[model samples]
Target: MAEVTYYTEEGLAKLREELQYLKTEGRTKIANAIAEARDKGDLSENAEYDAAKEAQGLHEAKIAKLETVLSTARIIDESNLDTSKVLALSIVKIKNVKNGAVMTYQLVSETEADFKSGKISVKSPIAQGLLGLKVGDIATVSVPAGEMNLEILEISR
Candidate 1:
């Protein structure tokens, strides 16, 4: 069996919305594009038709993948989360021991990981190292660049 993927409430809601859009608006658009391309005549020489068909194929594949992900998604309730130790969905603040730089990240699932939003995947090196750690604990993460030692400054829900 495939591993179950966990998601925060907001992340799960966003996935649902994307799936709906793909089923409704996205499918309709793809159908219209195919129809318009088909109206241009000769199938053997119709570049537009080929492109449209390829696009439809890609769109359908995306929809299928999204549906599968949504079906297996498990939503986590943040209200019930305990911040006593670093864990999935915990907002952790850390300070780099070597550089004295500080950063905060919310550990989430791979699909919800976005560096721009300060969200890191639980599978990531830093998050994996930080998991199960408490405030004042040291996390030594192994990255492609090298090892980075960080001190946990805070942990919050």
Candidate 2:
């Protein structure tokens, strides 16, 4: 079964743009590279041609994967999201119970996750633990480092 991924409108638009680019400019660039490589050598012993072919395969695979992801994606309207509890697309503020260090993150789909931007994937351990939790709820999340307790401070769309 294909997994359905939820994406914000902006994220979905970005994905569509990327898919269009891959189908056009990206494919053209790869084709040109392959053609140039093919013209440079004998078919039997051309390393450049081989490399170009491999690159083309990889590029095509990426396009196919992106297409599948786009096909199964559902755009989420942020304005309609509930802010009463942590959920996908919810911006959550959490404080470490042990150290009192507070952090904020937006739970997003894997493709839209950018740790540096404080957007975490819904599949992430922390997000998973926080999902469906309300403010003042304590969640114990298991990370590679160790398990830590976090208190939900706020939830917003």
Candidate 3:
């Protein structure tokens, strides 16, 4: 069975957009390149043809990868997500037990993770540790920096 991947609405939209582009403009560009290469020389002796074929191979590989990704996608409903505990699509506020540093992060899909916006992938160590934790609950996570304890303060969205 194909594994199901959870994604937010925005993340799904982005994937759909990418798939559309690959099917349309991306394929067209690759086809054009192949055609140009074919026109330039003897089929077996042409480096341009070889390069174009390689590019086409790479392009199709990317398309197939995207297809697999889209096939497993399951978009999460933000409105139904509970705020009482950490979960996918939840914005959580946590305080570091050792350093007293506070931070907020929205647990999202890998596609939706944007550090600039404080969004983290649910698969990430910190998010994995925070999952199922409620306010006043403490979670321990290990990173390259070492293991740290974080206290959940709030959950929303």
For each candidate, give its TM-score against the true structure. 0.94, 0.97, 0.91
Per-residue lDDT tens digits of candidate 1, residues 1-157? Answer: 6678989889998899998998899989999998998899998999999999999899999989988898898988878877889989999999999999999999999989999999999999999999999999998999999999999999998
Model 2 TM-score relative to the real fold:
0.97
Model 2 spans > 4 angstroms off:
none
Residue range 44-63, candidate 3, lDDT tens digits: 99998898899989989988
Residue 2 CA error for candidate 2 (Å)?
0.4
Candidate achieving higher lDDT, 2 or 3: 2
**At residue 63, what lDDT does model 2 achieve?**
92
Per-residue lDDT, model 1, residue 14, is 89
Q: What local lDDT does model 2 show for residue 133?
A: 93
* lDDT of the candidates, in the order given: 0.92, 0.94, 0.92
